[model samples]
Target: MDTSEIIGQSIALENVFRILAKVAPTDTTVLVTGESGTGKELLVRALHKNSPRASKPFVPINCGAIPKELLESELFGHEKGAFTHAIRSRAGRFELADGGTVFLDEIGEMDFSLQVKILRFLQEKEFERIGGSRPHKVDVRVIAATNRDLEKEVDKGNFREDLYYRLNVIPIVLPPLRTRGDDVFLLADYFLKKFCDKCMIKNLKISSKARELMRTYSWPGNVRELENFMERMAILCENQEIMPEDLPDKILSAGGVEQDKMPVMPARFEWPRLRDMDDRKMNLKDFLDKIEEQLLLEALHSAGGIKNQAAEILGIKRTTLIEKLKKKQLG
Candidate 1:
């Protein structure tokens, strides 16, 4: 189905692709759900492209972006003089999308009253334009995407339950970027190359340390944020390689490398005193174990839970670190 456009090899994404492959050829209505910037619209486009109605027009409407008053006319064309601004009769999105596909983006934001009309269309494949005497039938596939939880909205009396059930015949949920593992680096590299080419500049490579910090930071804005950041770096980065210092402070802080919070060693090393152990009400063995555990945890965190990197930081073999972690029940 040429899902090459949808990037990511994570199991979470692969699962979504599998579902798409099975459902794209059919005329079943699809409901795509995900967090904002999770590529829900992109997925819907892919579905339309791979469907039987690929050659026809693919109409997209953002229900949330349009005003409630004018949205009806936008979806179903108003007749001439139907409203104050209706200069001439025009076809609506559904009519325009006849024999093709209709992508209703942010459908969860649709008005409850309008939702009744939508449900009617979904059931009967027909709708009437504003001030029109007759209903118009369309042969288009319906694909709706939303970041909002429609089921919750239905329970709250915001979304219609019948409409939710009608649209959710085939639900495709996209996973957030933070949970996609190495897909982050894959997408980062893709965006870096894309932006670098656009700017007519050499591609900037991300340093290993910078990549580690990126892996630790939760990307709240998902792919869109990463794409924007990569474009910014492409234009602003003077060096050919992106280092940890090139990343923003938020990422640095999330990775425990914030400048102001970094630890500094004393001028002279002082051995742990008896009073130090007594302060924590611990004996020598227990106090020393506590210190070891702290260092182990710190190493693990710094390495982003990579055993080999943590062992290198502690100057120990990976197997030895594993053994210690297992002994401490920290593995």
Candidate 2:
């Protein structure tokens, strides 16, 4: 539930954070546009978290997930016997989210008729439930997210232009993972540690070669795909390290780095000179910790997460290894 959980250190993400800081305090309707799985819902949640309505309810409904026939009643509620299934009167998302924030996800998939009601609500802050004559007013902040281009939908007569402009009062675009530079590795590490903690497993680390391959390969499914893949690895990988062989065929094929051609090498024994520290701009503790972490990860990988064997390989006692893991909070 952390507001800063939209993980990325890339400038594109930083720009989004900047915009979020400026706009989240108000009730202006925000339109979040991004490729599918770029974490649009996360962005909307962050917006609500920072908004004055943060203490209020946050209601989300997917326009694409729900059937068209039921979507109207789902959004605007219905009176008793409004439809065959409506045995009693019910409040809709808009009414339920009064004094709060309502997220309309995948708004592009919404039926045109429902779009009219949404548009009216945006204008009047009031709506009538199905089979109800009286108009119900609600003070709610609206946030909508879509992967499609609303301008194109508007031109095609699939979406109302006025609604598009109204909802797009403040626009936020999330960059896909492929374009996020080193953020791929950052997110990968974050997800790895997260899933490891969740499953109560020892720390899982990505091999440098695997990291390189991940960097080069385009993540078509973006952050969501990476998160799922890491969870799968946490449960499925036998070794503490994520190796090239462990990657999906799609990643291996896309990266085009054959494991047979590039086999793993033994750890080198290069002593880090003072010049090395100066070049890397790292202090002594950070430099040593980085080296120690890599060695520990390599040992764990070679021993397949066997603590005793890994400790023996590192020429350290089992207790020492456990202490280091604890210090690093990787346990």
Q: Across residues 262-310, which tens digit of lDDT does each residue of candidate 2 receive? A: 3365498567799888899999999898678667655765676677998
The lDDT per prediction is: 0.87, 0.86
Clash count (model 2, backbone only): 0
Backbone clashes under 3 angstroms, per model: 0, 0
Ten contiguous residues minimizing lDDT sum, candidate 2: 254-263
Off by over 4 Å in 1: 256-331
Best by lDDT: 1
lDDT of 1 by residue, 80-108 (tens): 99989898998999999999999999999
